[model samples]
Target: MTSVLPRTKVSDVLFSCCQLLDISVKWTIQYDSPPKYPHYDPGTSRQLLCDQCPPGSYVKQHCTATSPTQCAPCPDQYYAEEWNSNDECQYCSAVCKELQYVKQECTSTQNRVCECVEGRYLELEFCLKHTECPPGFGVAQPGTPESDAVCKKCPEGFFSNETSSKAACLKHTNCSALGFKIALKGNAVRDNVCQENTDTTPQKCGIDVTLCEEALFRFAVPTQLTPNWLNILADSLPGTKVSTENIERIKQRHSSQEQTFQLLKLWKQQNKEQDMVKKIIQDIDLCENSVLKHIGHPNLTFEHLNTLMASLPGKKVGKEDIERTMKLCQPTEQVLKLLNLWRIKNGDQDTIKGLMYGLKHLKTYHFPKRTIQSLKKVIKFLHRFTMYRLYQKLFLEMIGNQVKSVKVRCV
Candidate 1:
């Protein structure tokens, strides 16, 4: 450039040379010879300017004309650890578990390696589904990495029912307090345990029931058996010398019960919510059990059921309990006779109403297909004592009067 007014001294020139980066102490201006400036050959030396790294990465080296980006990418197993500039790559952090991960920042290259979790093989880079056993069974011997244990049957009393992803099987249903009799020792069902004891109580296997003995149906009348057994001597209610109106009342009661059952069945099919369905079921249960108790001719007598129903607490005597007890009565052959007797003796409204209510309890006993014929006989015999008269008379009361005033059957 230019010289200052007092021409620089050696010390001043030395200081000035320090300001010019290219100027070195070795360069000098001559006093006698003509002044010349030191210069580098154009082909031999070159100047360089550096561009900073784009966002997200730091530079490792300053770029020179000789190199393109000036800064190369950080080494694997390391990353640019700082802003602005970086001379060396930093090693990856030690957060990874054994066999679990690689340097997301490779120890030597750009990114880290990922590994599988411990004790598990890597599939799709993750722990996938687990092997499981079939239902009502469990893995036997042991489970393994290469091989799963074979399925096995559960023992009586205790059962390992389900095979799950877990190392062990799940426990299943037990029989404690069930009062069940083990039949063939219930086995496991699909992943579920079959209850050990299934029977609530033992029932006689089977019995052949022919028509009542001729003596019993014919001459076994009074002077032969006790008061309760009197009806056992006959099959038809009409022949039993019972009241006609009372007999008819029972038929009407049965019809009403059937109607209610059909309504409840429709309600069930509609698929109401759980709590509602449960309430409906309870009602249906009462009606069903009641019919069985009233109609069943257990030992040709319902004395047991009557006694049971009577003994039940007044508050606890839901219709269900009453009906179930009635089922113990055994047969309609006997029920029809009692019904006939009541109708003949008590033609009064209350008595007729009671018989009608009781008739609702008549449910056919479940027996062989042949028993259906016998049931038909009982039904037909009872049918002859039509309740239309009683129904007409009573029709004024419930059909004829208020519904609530209807007399309770057993009462």
Candidate 2:
């Protein structure tokens, strides 16, 4: 072995040294080289690398052998955020939708950014209102731009009386702590009601509270009557007059129906039930004359005629008469035809009184006995009240204790 190395082994060792030297040179070159930029060859049709434009700018002209690439800054409403070989800057086209506002303004290097306006949150690329906790629940975490409001049920000893997006559950009043007896226990939806320790007598009930509330609800005063009529009603109440401010506040705080309901509730609290009923009756009487004057007919309008025709006994009116009445196109004309037929059938009984009697006889009639009595009273008092008064009077009487039994028989 010491005498001489084999020629093949020496040759192999030389080849290995040459390969390592080549790899080392290549690695050194690659490590020392500058970073490659995005490039385009333009019309050269050759594999050539060219300098790229930096962020906020775009290439105006590709680099040639003798010159560097020409670049230009992006104009207003344009952006170019990355090193690029693009011919032109991209448009800043993002637009804020309804209930949204720009959180970050567009710039030469960046696109516009948007966020939801106050009281809303982002959801699936759309702005939506934050959830409001309903009565008996409270907000646990307020909403943010990216998240909806978090709500939780009010725990024991806590209450939340109103719907809210931000309000937390409130601790119920401790009547014992206040040196008073608890008149009513607290629940999630309402606070504990407290009274003096000395006051032990039970509270007096007023006008079958449940029945009265049901009657008030059925009245539908807001839908049926006008603001002027509401004012008149407010003035007619027996105790302290409802101020214009109070009415406005109620109207602002509640829907039309709720406004009327709240006002009725307040009035009920203020006056004796019997007095309220009596006053309502008197008001109705005053309005009846007005109703009659406005209608210009003591008997009924076309609507009333329609009801009468529908309720008439088939034996008395006959199918032919009913068919003829239905065939008439105009409501007034149909009513006149029915009246003529009715008059022909009965000589002296064709008047309003007779019509009332006939309507009463029909077992399937819609009008209640109270309505009949009110209509009869209207007939008796033809000499009194204005048309407006009569109309209101009739409506009030209809909505009284017998409201549940009442129906709009004549529109």
Off by over 4 Å in 1: 1-59, 62-120, 123-167, 177-285, 291-411
TM-score of each candidate structure, all chains considered together: 0.24, 0.35
Each candidate structure's count of clashing pairs: 44, 14
User: What local distance difference test score does each model get?
Assistant: 0.35, 0.57
Shift of residue 277 alpha carbon in model 1, Å: 14
277-365 per-residue lDDT for model 2 (tens digits): 55553554344334333322334444455566556543255656656555542432343345446543543232344445665654465
Q: What is the lDDT of candidate 1?
A: 0.35
Which candidate leads the pack in TM-score?
A: 2
TM-score quality measure for candidate 1: 0.24
